[model samples]
Target: MRRRRLRALLGAALTAAIAVPLVAVAGDASAATNSFRGVNWADARDNYVNGWVIPSGLTAADSYSTVYTKANGIIAGFQSLLGANTVRLPINPQSVNDTWWASYKGAFDSALAHGMKVIVSYWEADTAKDGYVDDPAAWNTMWDRVTTDYAGNANVYFEPMNEPFGYSLSAWVSLCSTWLSRHANIPRGRVLISGTGYNDNVTGVGAASALSGTLLSLHFYGFWASDTTRAAWTTNLSNRLGSYSSRTVIDEAGSPMTTGLTYTGAANQDGNVFTSYFAATTDLTRARQMGIVYWPGLRTGDTYSITRQSGSGLAVNNASGVAQLRWGWGL
Candidate 1:
């Protein structure tokens, strides 16, 4: 087994320079025009056990081609069931090399054809350095190729990297700066920046001038949270995500869907913790007219995935989970 499970944790391009608190990015008109209900398409090259073990039976032949082909149906389900307009996919460094870019474009094309905005981020499942931006050369190469591929596609968004916890806050922001200047051809509004730390908080980056103009992204899981009350959830939101909701998106928020997603005051594997958290988050996103994307739209052993399917066809697994997503998305 590749132990891909260990790394289980873990937008935009376009036009003008828009001003945000400490950051002023050009062409970030998204602050006024962006709003979406989205989901993450898990299982990129990041592996587990031996090689890449996705929902083992979710596709035919288990090849990269199959994976991308299947993604079409998976994404369609998200649109039909959750009313999702966005789908974030993680790409491994290898996938972006010249050898694989063409293959990966299938998933990208499938998403865009459905009118789904695509947000792609690079991740090193087995990084030599856990918290630092590992494999700088590979990371840059991946972004360079991907940015070039979708440079002007409004539906495609570029997220330089995901969960950049290895670098210090200052170091990370510096990296963001370098990324902006290096890929200047891509507009600021089309990009998305991970917050400080494991993307658990965004207050610092959201306030940094260098990071302005781009949208902000954050991740949430039950393990990352302790607060089970709505009030606490609200306070936490106000502190971490409140400042930039207009240009922020919760690209990864989730909980176990095995129990079927019903949430009530009474505690259950499907209740209290995740329910309260999403409740507050949904309320905030709606109030601020922000974007929201749930984590693991589909992943094996990850109870958080909202859709349950086998071999890439439409086999809806968790109506409870989907229902909550609908509620969160205001469907």
Candidate 2:
């Protein structure tokens, strides 16, 4: 459960470089660039791509290929249905080390082929014994190989791990710093450093000047709060995000999009947590001109998936998620 939330804020980043013309049009602050827009193309039991070894009763030798068709079909919806320019995909360290990445390469290529930037994120090898990304050795090895394969691709981005909240802040940053040193070829701008403590805040991360150039990844969810008022929710997100908006990405902000705009369920039965949080979050991102990625771009079991099965193709799920995201993107 904890692991899934961390990964729910999975890998995603496609920062659009801002090039404001010398002459700025009057009253155009909101027209400023929407840094990056994306979603987490999740992998669960049937579509788990972080498996170090192929699970039993599975058909493919590589992890991602097991769900290739579904992944490809979903990536197809990035442009028209979701109006997103980036996609975040979960990856296993062992798969990259053991050569599954060679076969699994197509899953990423499918997105890049469509001109969609791919943010390759590392989920824990075993969330049970090891926490989300516990083994430094395996992680180092995985990134070494993965970076070598994608060092030159401008469309590909790398995130060390989804959320390293378990480790001390210093230790987590140290690990990331080491990763930066080891993989110098992967541009710092292309790397994403997850904030501490379930990635709820990036203040500390933003202060780490040694880790400059890399983008910050933050996750906001209703479970973290009971306050549904727009002011409270907006303040919480803005305060936690601090001054990182210029280079930060809210890679995961999702609720029961399956239900309509009004949410009434276990997580939000007492309050309109879904609607308020989504609205405030969208407002904050839009105000700051940042970017966001919805959780579970198109995965089973997660209603936050803004994707659905179309006529032999994929489409955004019928819900307020699409509108909320589009609102933030100014689309």
Candidate 3:
């Protein structure tokens, strides 16, 4: 997740109203972007680990059955509490290409068993948080195993890498193209190529003929700018997408959910930055008919986490945050 970076607003205010028709255009076999009503299930450690990754609420010593049961409850809470139909999880070389993988599959299997779509994304280890793949050989090997296991599962999606800021725009596109070539058996519709620069922009990747049929990933946050208006926030996100909104998924948009910010009523009039940001994001995503996966749906200690561990189960930390998310999903 691109935590904080303040940049100037792109241009003069664009209209808050998105004039695009809500007609559902089919980009891939999956139908439309709205089909993915999702939330990111991030590790409490922020998914940037030096060793094996374990999502919050799951221990390193848990068995396959234990992982399954635990993941099922969390996934169930996501669905029941937030109307989420998809869960995006993080993976790494250590997490996927080790003995722990046997038990980890249980989490993936349980999500699939619940009829929820799973987006498995790669996160660079913290030892080298430079946004480049740590080791090409190990990276490919990890993907080889991951794609081999889930290539046949229609509900599973693969993201090449998360926020690859280390590569230039051209280099990132080249890397994504290489990934597509390596895993050609996986349908292009099932692959999500992240935008260049912390997954912030998708126009370059979307226009690449080599990545035509693939989906795009975008991450937008309120802290990226000091824009205080709904129109500015909407324009900020729209500028990053360009003409690829149809194939783009705003998979990592979030703000402070537990800080007692009201998401209801006139958002522009709220005056709080987070309220305006959340309102503009949800409204714009809904207007564009795009998929939105909130960041850190269950990350412990994160104020942005919408849900928290309540005993053995999960409880919502912010009902209004979820309501705004559901509104974006058009639920």
Q: Each candidate's lDDT (Cα)?
A: 0.66, 0.67, 0.82
Off by over 4 Å in 1: 1-34, 44-68, 264-271, 310-312
Would you give me the overall lDDT of model 1?
Answer: 0.66
Query: For model 1, how does the per-residue alpha-carbon lDDT over 197-244 read when each residue is reduced to its tens digit?
Result: 566666666777787788888765554456777667777777666456
Candidate 1, 109: how far from true, in Å? 1.2
Q: Estimate each model's TM-score.
A: 0.82, 0.81, 0.91
lDDT of 3 at 160: 92
Residue 266 in model 3: shift from native, Å? 1.2
Model 1 weakest 10-residue run by lDDT: 11-20
Q: Residue by residue across 280-305, what tens digits does model 2's lDDT show?
A: 88878888888787776766556666
- Misplaced by over 4 Å in model 3 are 1-31, 267-270
Q: How would the candidate models be sorted by lDDT, starting from the highest? A: 3, 2, 1
lDDT for each residue of candidate 3 in 1-331, tens digit (9 for 90 to 100): 3232221122111112212222333343234598889989888777888788888899899999999999989999998999899999989999989988999998899999999999999988877877789998999999999999999999999999987777766677778889999899999999999887678777667777778789999888887677777888888888888888889898888888888877867833247678888889989889988999998789888899989988777999888888888898998
Off by over 4 Å in 2: 1-33, 46-71, 129-132, 262-271
User: Which residue pairs clash in candidate 3?
Assistant: none
* Model 1: residue 76 alpha-carbon error in angstroms: 1.5
